[model samples]
Structure formats: C-alpha cells, structure tokens
Target: MDERDGKHQDAAQPEFRPYHHPAAGWGAAKSVTEFLVRERELVNGPRAIMKMNHENGGFDCPGCAWPDDTKGLHLDICENGIKHVTWEMTRKRVDREFFAAHPVAELAEWSDFDLEDQGRLTEPMRYDPASDHYVPISWAEAFALVGRTLQELDSPDQAAFYTSGRLGNEATFLYQLMAREFGTNNLPDCSNMCHEASGRALQASLGTGKGTVDLKDWEMTDALFILGVNAASNAPRMLTALAEAYRRGAQIVHINPLVEAASTRTIIPHEFARMATFRPTRTGTLNLQPRIGGDMALVRGMAKAVLEEQKSDPKALDVEFIERHTAGFAEYRALCEATSWDEIERQSGVGRAEILTAARVYCEADRSIVSWCLGVTQHEHGVDTVREIVNLLLMRGNLGREGAGPSPVRGHSNVQGNRTCGIDHRPDEAFLQRLAGVCDIDPPRAHGLDTVGTVEAMHRGDVKVFVGMGGNFALAAPDTPYTSAALRKCLLTVHVSTKLNRSHLVHGRQALILPCLGRTEKDHQRGSLQATSVEDSMSMVHLSVGMKRPASPHLLSEPAIIAGMARAALPGSNTPWEKYVEDYDRIRDTMAQVLDGFEDFNRRVRLPLGFRLRQPARELVFRTPSGRAEFSTAALPDVVPVAGTLALGTMRSHDQWNTTIYSDNDRYRGIKNLRTLVFMNADDMRDRGIRRFDDVDITSTARDGSTRTLRRYKAIPYDIPRGCAAGYMPEMNVLCAIGDYSTQSDQPLMKHLKVTVEASQPAG
Candidate 1:
C-alpha cells in the first residue's frame, strides 16, 4: 500500500524490472485494451471514437499537438490517444449523491488518479463550506454567482482568467474576448508554464513563434535532430514518422540527459508486417546524453564543428543564405570560435569526437530539422538554448525550405490554437486593435499576468477571483505547496471542467465547479450539433466534430459556459455572446476578421484537411525589426557541476498526460506501480551509497535560502548522466521554487532543478 494517498494496491516494494519490449508494439496494444476494459468502453467507444480521432470531420485527440497524417491511415490513434479518449468516455459519473457522500476534505486526500477516476462531473456544483461538501447548483445560479463575484471585485485586475490547451479555438477566442471586454488582461494560461520559452525564442530568432515544418517535411528531410523530446510516451504518433525517417536512411541524432528507449528503437503499431513479425525499427542514429541544462553547450559545440568544417569545405556553411536572409552571424561565429573544446566537453558530457560526428551528419545533409519539447524549454536559460538551436539551423540555411527548420512539439492538442486565437496575457497593439474593431468594444490595453505572475499576485493579496477555463492549475504549477496556498487566498475560484481534479478540491473560500462537455462528447447548441477547430503543431487548423452523447444533459459545452458567464457578468455589453454560442461559425467569422492568416476561415477550414495557416518564416519572409532572421549572441549558461548535488528534471510517465496520471506505471522506463521514485545514474547511486528501492530524501534549496524536500522517495538506478537525475512531475514539482523560472519567458525551470539525495533507509 502506498502511504501517500492510501489507494494503490500494488506490492509495497515497488517493481523495477527492465522492459525489453519495443515501445508502442504489443505493450501499447495491451495497454489500450486494458484501458478500454477498465473504462467499460471496449465496444462502441474504440470502434467509433478512435476512428474519428485525427480524421477529417472528426474530433481531434485531446492528447499531443502532433500534426495528423495526410495519408489518412485507417487508425491514426496512438496508445496515449486511446487512453485519453477512453478516459474521457468512461461510463462512470460523479453526481450529486457522490459528492454528498464525500466531503471536500476527504476528496482532497484522494490521489489525483483516484479523484479523476470517480469520473465525469454531471452538473454544476458549488462548495458549501459549512457542510464541507459540494452541493448541486443550477447553471443559471452558478453563472450568477460568478458574475456577482467578478462584479463585486474591487478591481478587474483582481480577477485572473486561466486557459488550458485542451480548449478549442472557438471557445478560447471567446474566453479571451470576455476577459478583455470585462476590462482585465489577467489571462494567465498553460502556455505560460510549458511553451512560453519556445514562443519567445522563436519569435526573437525567426520572427515567428511557431514551427515552419509540417508532417510532410519529415519524409523529405536528410537529417533530423531530436533534442530533449521523448516522443514515445508524450506523443506516440511521432514514432511512426521517426520509424519512416529511419527506414529512409535519414541520420537521426537524439540528444538528451537520458537515452529514452523510444528514441533508439520503436515498433509502429500500425505497420501490419512489422507488428506481425515483432521487428523494431531503428530510430536514432546517434544518441547523446548530456548533463541537465547543458543543451546550450552541446549545440554550441556542434556549431563550432560546423564552423571548423566551413574552413576546409566552403559548402559546409550556407554563406549565401546567411549573408542574404540573416543578421548577426559574425558575432555568433566569434562566440563559437572563442568557446573552448574542453569547456564544451566538460559541460555537455559528450566528447569532442562525438560532437564532430554529429556535426558531420548535419553538415553533409542537404536539409535538416531540429525538434524539441519541454526539456529544452523548462530551464533557466531555455530561451537562450532555443536561440542557439536556431543559430545552428540558420548556419545551414535550414529555414524557409522543405524538410528543415525548428520544431517545438507541443503537448496539448489545441495549445497552439489557444495562443493563435489570442489566449495571451500580453496581446500586441495590432492584435488588440483588431479585436476591438471586430467586437465593437474597448479592450484593455494593459498587459496581464502570466501563470507565475498570477500565483505571485494571488499570494500578495493582489488577486481575488480565479477563473480556470480548464486544467489542473494547482498541481501543474511549480512549487505545489505555494501554489495551493495562493489559491486558497482567493475569495472565489471557478473551474470550468469536464471532470473533478485536484484543482477542484483545492478551492477558495467560495468555489464553483461548472461542469462542461469533453471533446469526445457531442456539443449541442441551438438544437444542432456543433464542431470546434484546433491548430496542430504544424499550424494546421482543422474542425473537430464530436459524436457521442454527453456524459450528462446538465453539462454544457465550453463555448456555452463562457457565453453564459459573459452575459451574466456584463449584462450591458453589446458583444453577441448568445449569437456566437448559437452558431460557432460566427465565432470563426469574427476570428478571421480579427486574426491574420485566417482570411477564409469558415470556407477553408471545411476543406478536406482544413487549411495551413500562412507561416511567414516558412516563406522566407522575416517580420523581425531587421527584416531578416537574427542570430543570437547570448552567452553560454554556467553548467559547472555543483558539489554534492545532482541536476534533476521532471517528466511524465508513459501512462500519463500532462498532470493527469492514468496509472502508476511508466512502461517505457520500466517503472511499475510507483510515481515517487527518483531515477539516478548507477555510478551516482553507488557513490552516494544508495541502492535500488532505497528510500531516499531528495531536497532542493531555492535561491531565497528556503529548502523543499521530498521525503522517503524510492531511488532507482538507471542509465543517465552521472550528475543528472529524473523524476515524475507534479510529485517532484514541489522541489521547484515559484521564482525559479526562465528570466526571458517566465517559464518555470522544471528541467534544471538542483537537488541532493540522502539515503533515508535501505531497501526493506
């Protein structure tokens, strides 16, 4: 039994058997089947919902932001996608009786998986502090309560609107519009926590925040460099593309602290012949395990090798492209030359020979693509590191062409769409002006708070009302204890969600749980089914039409709920909240008029695979102040090894999606029935006198001299860099300080936590 939540039934001694099977082959198939049976959705759920996922005129998978395959495979769903769909389509319901039987205090003690496992929320529920339980409340009453609270706030800045990436384009557009029209730009969102660094760095380097490549580029690339991204567990669909790239002999180099199993080899479940024979396809041609926060050094080393090769082979560098389309090359080249090989080897944990080998592959390739995820963007120098990657790409003239560019793979399905639809805390003057003209309202001109800023403001008593459009903000935010306490300080907290999560239990003095429809459920508006749109990682905007009946009749669509709140909050407002809710096309029409690159939104989005938003960077059109791509000259990060401490990074397990834990097992890493285990290098474990399954206390000291510790966590030895460690997030998030965020993007440095582990007890 796990003492933490008192629910897990696995053996008291955590299992650590190495998984020899290839990822997403038999293991994925079995996992999918098990989830279906567990959710009692083995029949029509998989047959119908699974087919609709990632297909034209079907609902998008509420999983990763990977672009859909235009080849239209019969089954495009991945194991995690199936898990998400089945998890949402679970038959279990959390109704009034369920809440009546359990008090909020009791529910708060339940584990995240157990709480969400209680299933879909049925109706709007309001917290009754006297009874310590949630009681059913009518939708109208809930809306009125939210409206009254917002209206009663001392200032509009006292309220912060939070958006999760799962929200669709139509709903997200309306959400931001409502917040702006209500005179507050405090629109803190999930992007602030995850990909803010990517956006900031890309916008600065290439004049565009999004990736320039589509799925088609994967097939055309000569070399693919994957950095700090674990595709198997995070975005399983990417495995298929990687396998194909491998078969086509594209040199793939995977660089990270841990050599992820999927990055080396993967079995594409959809490949019938390979699946029948159990043959795993090779993925990474070379894998580099660097120390945590050493990516900048590793990339700079590659640049140095390329520069050296340019001396001998003039073709090694695209001199003409750099001279015509880029600026600041001389400064960047000087920095690379000034940097020493000894410093690079010491910092990146990779030898000079290996760096040169990787550089040779990159230089020889006609076109190459570099892709990354949270690992690259969740560090103190995340923005600088990404800019370095852009520098490497620009040296080879990899941008503005097929099969080349920087790819920041997003985690959430519509996360990119949310930002595209104006879910930004700091909207530009042009965007705000367009929105104001389209909506016929004077929007707020002041910049709003991001996730970190919102938490700080709440703690300082500057914020009162917290409105979460979707997401488990309490658990997902860094410094879990601080965030929870900050949330409790709010006068009123509201969550518009499809299910009960930790954020619901960790509430304010007065809280409202406004239940909403999930992505798999049919959204009925004005007696007709409605479809929403989402933008994938490649900037492809496509419609998502749900087919299944809603978990409950009382659950309204996200757009409907936002409209209700807007109407109740601003009774005198002239925005057509009701009309937009009735016809989603109205939302699209207004969005096209407001946002760029959506000129023919309604008509174009209805086409076969929707439409690709115009990426100026892809067309070699730089919108930077220099009117060209800019090479960064930022100094390399200080990556010297600290005494008696290991750099730790938090990651999700195979059976997890963001903050939602599906199970305790991490299939790819071979961690079973446990989430509190810290993975350490064998050498480090031996040196520290810590054995496998030993209970160890991991502690981190914040810059403010405060310390956070995770007590009695099992320490497991694994294949990783000597001075680097890995652990599951949200559990390890406690060790991250609230102020420990990237200086440039304000994204929490979840991937560069400095921690020390001390043995608490030997394996029992």
Candidate 2:
C-alpha cells in the first residue's frame, strides 16, 4: 500500500455507545465550532457568514434545499449549514504547488475527505499523463482544448454534459442552453441519483413534479408523515419546523426502517430559551420500522385501513374531492380493498395494528403533509412507493391546499432549481419550441442519456467528452468501480469544481480541473458584482449574492466558465455567450422568455423572499394527460425476502454532506471514528453468529447474476428492524450495480441492496 493512503486512516478500532441525547443542542454547537476552527474560520466564522445564509438578498446556503423562513429569523443556519459554509470558506489552497508534490496516483489513494480537505483549487489545471500530475493551464488554453476536443467528436452525441445542484439558476440555464445548442440533450445531473423517482412519480400523478407545500404549511398542518428520511443529518434545518409543529400539537409520524434519533426528539439551537433550559421537544408521535423495500406495501396497508374505515364513515375520505379532482380512484380503491392483511403484513414487515394506528392518525387530520428523502426514492420500487405516498395524500384531498400535500425533501441546496432551469435529459416539446423561438437555435429532438445511460454510453465507447458543471460525479454515482472505469473510457473529462474531490483523481486520458467561485465567494464580472438565483424544495426562487471575496483571483464564476466553454466550442453560434457572462441578468432575461413561470425573472427574483414559481397542482390544475390528479394502481413490489441475505440501505453520516465526508463519525448513531461499519439488527447479527465490532465481509449479487464485495467492514448491532442493515454511502455504493435501477425512473437502488454478511479473517 502507498504511504499517502494511510494519512487519513480510520480509527484502529471502532467505538460504540448509545447516544440518548436530543438532536441539535450543545453537541451540534460544539461540532459547528470545531469545524469552523478546523477550517480556519473560527475567529471570523459563522457569526458573520451565517447571518447572511438564507437571509434576504444574501447567498442561499450550499447545504440542503429546505426553504428559507419567511420571517427571516436571525441566525437562520443549522449545524450542517455552518459546516458547509466553513468547508467552502476554508483558507487552505490546493494550488500548483500541492499538485506538484502529489502525483495523481498517490492522490487517488487518499480518502475522499482528505482530498477535499486539501482545500480549494486556485486555478485551471490539466492532467499531464506523461508527468502523472496536473500542471496549471491558462483559461484561454483550457477553453481552446475543450473546444477542439469537442468539435473533433464524430457526433455531438459523443459528448455528455453533467450538472450538480451547487450551480445557481442563471448558470444552469446557460449550461442547458449551451448543451442543447451544441446539439445534444445528454444532460445528466445529481437528480438522476437521488430524487428522479420523486419527479417522475409526481409528474405522472399530478401534472407537475414539484412539492406543493412551503414552510408556512408546516405551521398550519395538523399531521406530518415523514417517510424514509433521516431528518437530523440530511436536512437539519427542517428540525426547527418539526419541533415547532410538535410543540403546537401536530401529529408527526416517522416511518423508516431505522429509528433515527432526530426523528424522535430535538432541541432547536436557535431557540435561546430551550437551548438554555435543555428542553427537548418530541418530534415524532409515532415511529414505524418497516423492512427495507417494504414502503410500498406499508403505504398500501395504510390505504386499506383508510378504505375500511371509510366503509363505516364516508367522511374518512374526501369523496367529493376524489370525484371532482382525481381519476382512477375506483381502480385504486379496489386494489387496496383486494389486498389482504396477511399479504400486507408479510410484504411490509409491519403489524396490522400498527399500520391501522398510523392510518387512524391520517384519517383524523383535516390537513396532512407527506415528506420524504432518498430513503423513499433510492429503491427498486422507489417510483411506486412515491406514487403510493401521493395516493395517500390524494385520498385526504391533500392537493391544491395549504398544509396538505407531498414534500420530497431535496438534499442539495439547488438541485430542485437545477431541474427548474431545464437541466433535463428528456425535456418536453413545449419547452424545446419556446427555447428555440427565444434563443434562435434548433435543439435535437432525440432523447438523451441519463446518469446510468451516460455510464453505459461511455462504457460502449459512444461518449468521448464529459463535462461536469460542479459535482463529484465519480463518488456520487452508483457502481463505483463500473462508473470509474466508464469515466476513464472518455477521451477527455472536465470538471468545474470548487475543491479537489474523488472525481479529479479518477480521470480520463485527458482532464481539466476548472476551479469556480463558491457560493460564499463574490462574483464580480466586468466591474459589476453579480448575484445568482436558486429554487428551494418548495418551489421558491430566490437570489443568492456572495459576501466574501473569491478564494483566488483566477477563480471564475460558474456562469463565466460555462459561457467560456460555449463560446470556444460553438464559435459559429449566434448566441450572446460573452454578454451572458458579462452580466447574469442577460441570462435571466433569456430564461424568462424561454421558461414557464419566470416571465419577469429579473424583477421577481429580487423580491424580499424571491418568488414562488407557479405550481399547477397547488392550484387544483393538473397538467396530466387526463387533466386531473391520477391515482396509481401500480402493484405492490414483490418484496419476498431472501433467506440468507439482509436488505442493506446506504445512508449519509451525521458528520457528512452528500458525497462529502466531514469526519469519520456518526454522532447521532453513537458510532465514532469509523466510516466502514454496518449497522445491523441485534437479532440478525446474533443469528448470523456476528458479534459487535466483528469484521464482516458483505457480498451483494446484482440482477445480472454478478456479485460485488466490501471486505472487513465492522458489524455493529443496532436498533434497526430484522432482515435489514444500514451503512454509510459511497463506501457501500460499490455494491449497487448500475443495472440495479428503478425501471420507472432510472434511479440506482442505492437504498435496497440484498447482501449476505459473514465474519472475515483479519489481514495477515
């Protein structure tokens, strides 16, 4: 093994202790302080930057996609938000000197955390295979190289453009426009891996794909059903809303295989009175632990219970709304009625009594909200599960009303906005016509490759040039080994990134690292300070203007980088690429003309809390082919458990963001200094003759009859349901095959890996 590989090694032995404390108290504060100091931002840290996060006219946090509070409360940041800001505002630099000292091979051996911890990239760098290192390249040279390589491709389809949620609306608009004009719709993004199922299912059911509820709905809702989400870590800012709702006598039901600490209790750090008194509020009134891949059956069971109660009292369901606003209810109701209790129990791994209890809660509430994250989307039956959730909400007349709807909690700050700005592989025909009329370019009509399709295309040698707008694609994608191999097959790869990550190391024969300005960094173009816009999970669009100076003078904004590449690659195009870069308003102006719901983009975006895009489903307007919200009759997933394997789900740790590890600890789960530990049920571990902290090898078989293994992962007994196991992502992502994706949405089933575990021998 290389010596550099050992630099950020995990603890020699893992430590396990049950953490009984509420989420987000002194513990969260301490973690935030430690990260600020470690990133060298302590003295001039969170107090200054956090004040601007999610505030009016300030930069939106590059964290989760939770909407900003309408009241604009002071210190509108969470612990994870603080970590994200400090991590971006670090003083460390990964300049030419650092690359000169470390070869690409050696850096490849370093952990993901260490690579990003090296700090921000200072300038453009290109891979020199002869020297086995990256050397600095001028911006003009970089642009010329990218253009020359792209122009040389036999077909425009030979290139693929990927986007990350970190980009703002203006940049994403230019990015998609550039790619479509360049003649391909091969725009795969982070959404393909996480919430594609949500969008696909929601769009099918309700004409629109976005959530219907906003932050204010949380205050008025009588019941909140949080499904398959780990709120404490993934969306910490959401805890304040949950706590407030709990305090106001709202019924909160948490349904997941694992009993997450944050779902049970929490103390909002910003609430001075509660923080000082250490009074923890109970966030969840009921917690349900279903087997992995069992959400569809559980949701069906709840529907069945509701239907049974409806037989006794017609008021149990909003019959009037169903007849007036929805279609396919009769068939859906029949499907639920025909599903027997025994079958529901067998498939869901939940008792009928408990399912009925949850159903009763939903039936009693006049207004209800159903929210979910990756847990509900990263499954083979993810789309079906999401559709079932909508069916439950639809039964209660949840659409087009305040405090009643579906909320697919997005993780990335602007992932939802990326989609809103037209970052799609298969854009609709209306959007294309409008874009063509507005931009005077004929876009390709052919459907393009998605994330999984991009990998397949690259492997088949169809794609030659790959350009990423701002994400660690290598680590974020599933089938890590397969994705890496596919990435290497590209003729040239480019990443517009803020810091060094795993994607930089696993490169194509030729690669370019184009460092861009972070969200907290000021973007000054042509002597004018610029601001970009992003859309939150609730469809709220707002401007984000950076307050801090750029980490390096050479760093360019994402818009500038996209415009540079577009100008170089398509010199013959008539689009005003240079003008778009000079001022972002030009980009927004064009976007307003092209996109729906952004007619007055520039003026509306500058409003106090920005503007709420038109959500048709929120106003009882269904865009579906039937012109009504449709009830899904999709069958329950065949969840027959394999006798010897456990259903494992990949998750993020408390000290981590999506695909970015902040530390080797999961404080909420009571695990310390380890990222390779698998949380298993105590009975399951005992049944398998595995003890706590025992080194175990986990093997998963793909649908193609091929198997992958992760060796020597410590097995920790925890409170998860039997026949299910949980582990941190990216590490376990290797076990997820590229072919193991939702047939409906094409999202990798990262949350449903059927694996068998056995004790492994210690290394000799």
Candidate 3:
C-alpha cells in the first residue's frame, strides 16, 4: 500500500563501481552535461535565468547556504546550483492528465527521482481515498478543507506546523505567525533535526547562537580545522575558500573518519587551466581519521597539548584575552593539565604525537577558524562536542577577531534564516512579546514539540493536523517507518511544494498537495514582481528574485498559500494576512520591529547582496549570564559498542543535497546506481566474513533493546576506519530508532548508530 513497496521501479540489480578522482574536475563537467540534457526543452530559459542568479536582480541559488562574493561576483553558481535551477526550470509539467494516469498507490511505487522528475506540479491535488487517486481540486476548496480540518481539532495543540529551509524569509514569517495565531507553538522545523545543538551550544558559550565569522574572514585566518563535514559533496563552493586558505600558507586540517575528495584535492572551475584539464589543487595539510564519536576526546587531546606547550611559554596562550574576556580558564586549564594521555588516546583513537602535531600548528598560528557540520552535531553528546570546540577557540583568543571563530556550516540554503524568522518551538520570550505587540495576539508562552516530540504526539493521536511548508518529511526524518506511521495517523496532512515527493504518498486520512512557485520563477503579487530573501551560513541576508516565468500559471507562492490557509483557519484573527501576501515588504517591516537584528529589514534586503544580521559575539561580547565566554566541563562520551558491532553513519551522496537525491552515483566516492550500498573498511569486512558486493543484513540496536533490520544491502570495501560503516540516508534512516537523539538539544543522533552487519543469502 505504501510507496516504498517500489513495485514500479526496475527490479534489476543496481550497478556499483569505485570512483577514483578528486572532486570538481571531470565529475563537475558531467553535472553540467546532465543539466544541459535535463533542461534541453527550455535551454535559453535556463541560461538566461542563471544570469540573474546570485546577482543584484536575480534570485539566490536555492542550493547551499554559502555566501556569494557579490563585490566581485560572476554567475558565481556551481554545478549544483545549475542542477537545482535547471531542475526547477525544466519544461515538464504534471497536469490533470498526469494525475489521471497515475494513482496515489501507483505513484507510491515510484522512486524519489521518478516522483520529482515527473515535472512541476501544475495544479492542486487532493487524495481521493475511495479511488486511491489524487483528484484535481481548486485552491479555494483545498484551503477551505485545510481550514475546516484544523478548526475541527480538539485543541490547538493537535496541530503541528513544520517548516523547511527552502521557505523564503517572508513566507517563514507568515507561516510562524499563522501557527502562533492558531494558539499553538508547534513550529518544529528542519533545524530541530540538524543544527539545534549548534545553536544551543553556541548560545551558551558566546551569547549569540550563530557563527561569528563572515566570508571575508577566510582570507585572514592562519589555520583552519575542518571537522566531521564532507565539504566537497555537501558544499562544493566552500572548497574555493579552503583552496585560497592553503594557497595563502594557512595550515588546513581535515578531521573526518573517511577521506573526502574535496578535503584531499579540489579543482576550482572558475580557474581556466584546471577547468580545461580537470586538474586538482591540494587542500588538506593534515587529514585526521579518529574513531566514530571520538571528536570530543580528539579535541580534548588537542587542548591538552596546547596546555603542555604553554607550560614552557606562558605567553604562548592568550593571557590578556583569557583573563579579561573569558571565564573558567583556571579550572579548565587544571583539568587539561591533569588529563591522562592514555585516557585521551584511548577515547580519541589518536596518538599523542599526532595530537601534538596538530596542536603545535594551532599554537603557532596567529588566528584560527574551526568549521564543522552535522557530523559533529549528530551524536548523543552533540552539544558537549560543540562546546569543546568553543573551548579550543577560546583558549587561543579566537573570538571577535579577524579570521578566527566557530562556524557550524549549515547544510540547507535557508535553515538559519528559517530560525531567524521564528520557525521554532522554543521561542524566546522577548521575540514572542515583539510578535504580540506587532500582531495584537497573545503568543503562546509554553514551549512546543520539536521534530521528535511532534512525531510522538502524532503517534499518540495528540496531534491531528500536519502542515509542512516544504520538504519531504516521511523520507527525510529518522525512523522512517515510525515517522511514516505518524503521518498516516494524522487527520489531515498538507505539503506546499513545487513537485511530487514521497511524503505526498505517505498520506494521512486526508492529504493535499498545493503546488508552489520555485525560486527560479517570478512571484508577482500586489501588482508587482515580489522578491524573497534568504540568510546564508554567515548570517548574511540577501534578496533572491526569480527571472523565468512560473512553471505553472496556477501555482501560488508560499506566502500566498500560507495566507489563504491562515485566513480560512483563523477566521476571527485580525492580523493583516492578505497584506503580507500582497507585499512581502510589509512582512519584512514587521520583522524589523520584531527581530533583534533585522532593523531596516526592507531597505537592507534591497541592497545588491543584502546585509549581515547582528552577531554580538563578533565584538567579543558574550550574551551568557556570566557576561563573559563560559567554559564547559563536559566529559568525553561513553561510546563503546557491543561486540561484533560496527558504528554506522548516514550521509548524503555526491549527487544529493539534504533529502533531494539528484542521482544514485556518488561520483566523488566513485559510486553509481546503488543507493543501497554500504561502505566498510576492508579489514572489518574480511573479519566479519563479508566481501565487496556481499549481500548483508544490517541491524541497528536501539537503546530500548529493540532493533530494525535492512535487508539485501551490498557491502563495499572503502577507506573508512575499522569497525565503521557508511550508508546513504532515507534508505538507511529506517534503521535509526525514534528515541535515538542528543539528550541536551533533542536533535537526532543521525550520524552515530550502533549496528551489526551479517552476510545474507542471495536471491534464489
């Protein structure tokens, strides 16, 4: 009955191979070629549309959160950007005929690629349970049905509103406002799953929850520690910054369990010779492969080395900065000095000599920056791990200085912006008060459910209505079967999106898909072509205006969709919902009054590259209770696994971004046509009687003594550390249990998993 049964996909065995090359050479060329082929029908539209992308008049690339160098900007978009734009600007359409030809049950059997590749959704569709097919529905009826279902909820708490990173700042503001007006704070967003820990940790230590350094700081740093992130596959444009740092004699170190191609070498396509020959530029000066979940200990070992070095040279440490600007250094220094090398080595799986080598580089550097992604924040102790990284930077007087600070590299395009616009369950009281003052409604003071809590609430029948601004929740969330069941239990589920996704198939009793305009299309409302905005990883807000015509004349912009639903649902509410939809500037003006750093929001966003939001830590001011940077004393996590178990980590493929799988091949790792493949160390594979391409059954053990098994996954030998395995998510997400998450931040432990892999019998 579910789409995952996959009856429509080709049952033939998938192809697999080892890719052998650094990133951004021939592989990037292939991506461009693929984009050309995919968008052949609307060829000039893509090229003309791209000219506006990341420019003053064009839209921001709806890909990564990496900032654009607007001062010296070219097209400035990468292959990934092209693919995203091309995919959005494709000529294909899913009209009434397409829906008539395919039932919901049949569409469920299609793969993720097939579902999205069917083309842009041209009209609204409602699930007809009796027919098992989606029937065309007018926007008015769809909005009215959603409103009726929501109004019928036993209590406001029975509704959960989910927001994704793709939503524009204006839409996010309206979405959260509508939820608050509805009297519930269940504004769980994608950030709750990815970087909630980063926000929690950074806010505790630095007064501000966001990263302090901007794009310009990359040039001034003397050393960089890139941890737990596969920069090449995730943020291809970031490699340019890394390459520039290395070129300028900055020591670059990559700390990851697997050797990512971009960390080793990358070719900047903007450079002529490399673009012609696909030759690579060297990146990482040191590549450290510590045991899975050992980042805290590894960082502690580095800190201990710094302390030892300072013993001989007291001036080696930033005495003035530490004594004046930070707290808890005395106790922290004592703990580091007293720490045993054996314990550090055992916990980190790193030798003392190697630790000292990296520490020495840090000691010699004038300024340093530490950047990390989900790898460091997807552990049970994610908050503690990030805190230790902050401790390391504080030891060197790195904060508030040029080229030195902590940057939690966000994966999504506007996830940070979504948080800025109040798409959070735990809203700060001051922000709520501002919203109340602006909207004349009593904002809910009680904290609401996060992603995990939302799922649990849905399962318990406490939440009956589910509304997703964007994103495929069923496929992106952990514990797939559980999450899917929660969605099915809902009285109504709605998704505002550009194309069909798996989440549409995993429906509730009643489901609605309201197709919307993508970032590549113009959004003309209030008799004007409105522009939307997004915040980059560095907290820089910029305007993004779509150039091409909308794929469908019927598709509504997200703000328009939210307005229709809001007016219908909150009939008595007095907020100017139509005004926001008519002119996005009104929403920005409201944000300027409501949010702390968004003063003059409309004026600033109209600039060529927008403006940077205020970051207090940028000026050495700590927003903590102590009025100074506070050091954390979290101990290393206890991560010992059961005997014969391998630590499993889930990651995205080269051809994927977040949950959107562009292709089956991870070209950087040399994988092709096999998303069900697992990467394992050769020694570990041999020890377990497993070989490359061997059929395996992988079981993930939950803390509650339960397990979920994935069958018929083929194991591939790779350069990963021993006793560690890597697999693509959504396919592997089912193995993760619902209760598996960080205790402090409530973020899922997506990267750290306990699993046992065994050889399985092949098909008869």
Regions of candidate 2 where Cα sits further than 4 Å from its true position: 1-8
Candidate 2: worst 10 consecutive residues by lDDT? 1-10
TM-scores, in order shown? 0.98, 0.98, 0.97
lDDT (10s digit) by residue, model 2, range 304-408? 999999889889999999999999999999999888899999888999999999999999999999999888898888888999999999998987888999999
Candidate 1 C-alpha lDDT tens digits along 1-764: 01131124355656898777777888888888888888888785666645565555588988998888898787887999888888888888999999999999998878888898889999999999999999999999999998999999889999999999999999999999999989999998999988999999999998899989999998899999999999998888899899999999899999988888778788888888999999999988999888898898999999999999988999999999999999999999999999999999988888999899999999999999999998899988999999999999999999988999998999999999999999999999999999989899899999999999999999998999999988999999999888999999999999998888999988899999999998888888889889999999999999999878899989899999999999989999999998999999999999999999998899999988899999999999998999999999988878765888999999998889988999999988988889888999999999999989888888887777778888788888998988889998878888899988888899988998888888975445
224-263 per-residue lDDT for model 3 (tens digits): 9999988887877888888888888999988998888877
Q: Which stretches of candidate 1 lie over 4 Å from their true place?
A: 1-12, 761-764
Q: Residue 82 CA error for candidate 2 (Å)?
A: 0.4
Clashing residue pairs in all predictions, respectively, total 0, 0, 4
User: Cα deviation of 146 in candidate 3 (Å)?
Assistant: 1.2
List RMSD in Å for every model shown.
Answer: 1.9, 1.9, 2.0
Clashes of 3: 4
Which pairs of residues have clashing backbones in candidate 3?
3-108, 19-670, 59-545, 207-623
Q: lDDT of each model, Cα atoms only?
A: 0.90, 0.90, 0.86
**Model 3 segments beyond 4 Å from truth?**
1-18, 39-49, 277-279
